[model samples]
Target: MLAVLQVILLVLDIVWWLVIVSAILSWLFAFNVVNARNPVVDSIGNFLYRATEPLYRPIRRVLPDLGGIDLSPLVVLLLIFFIQQVIVLYLIPAVYRAGV
Candidate 1:
């Protein structure tokens, strides 16, 4: 059970980094800093989009438009942070106390 919680933490960490990278890559693409025409870049962009889009879709539906600024990534990151904090601060300690 402890191992499972640890694995969940690891997965959350990976997702947090994925969201950060996706946001940075998107900014790069938007500013023309990276060539979207490059096959490698395109592939990476597509993979990131596919990985993160499902997470973003629900958040996007609830948020009002901000005039071309997307806040879904930020919202998702915050949620990930909150979940991590809960696991680390509350759930882990509770598990430790329960010895399971």
Candidate 2:
């Protein structure tokens, strides 16, 4: 059961990385660095925005706008990655248990 939990945590970490990549790509498309005209880019960007927006929305409200810039995405990324690190720490217990 401990080993199974470790595997689940690892998968969660992977999913967080996927979210980060999607957020970055979405920003790139929005800024026109990537061709937003492409159908695939459009779909991916919209979907990413939808996925990540809920986290950003509340953060955006409390935080002051930095001259129209939104730092909520950065905040979301940091929080998600930090939680992933905590999840990885659970594996040490699983390893110790396996030794016995």
In order, what lDDT does every prediction score?
0.97, 0.74
Tell me the number of clashing residue pairs for each predicted model.
Answer: 0, 0
RMSD of each: 0.6, 3.3
Q: What is the TM-score of each candidate against the true structure?
A: 0.97, 0.65
> What is the C-alpha lDDT profile of model 2 across 1-100, one tens digit per residue?
6566567767766657667877679668667799988898888878777777777899989999798567877787788777767656766565677773
Using TM-score as the measure, the top candidate is 1
Candidate 2: misplaced stretches above 4 Å? 1-4, 7-11, 90-100
Residue 74 miss distance in model 2 (angstroms): 1.4
Q: Superposing every Cα of model 2 onto the true structure, what RMSD results?
A: 3.3
TM-score of 1: 0.97
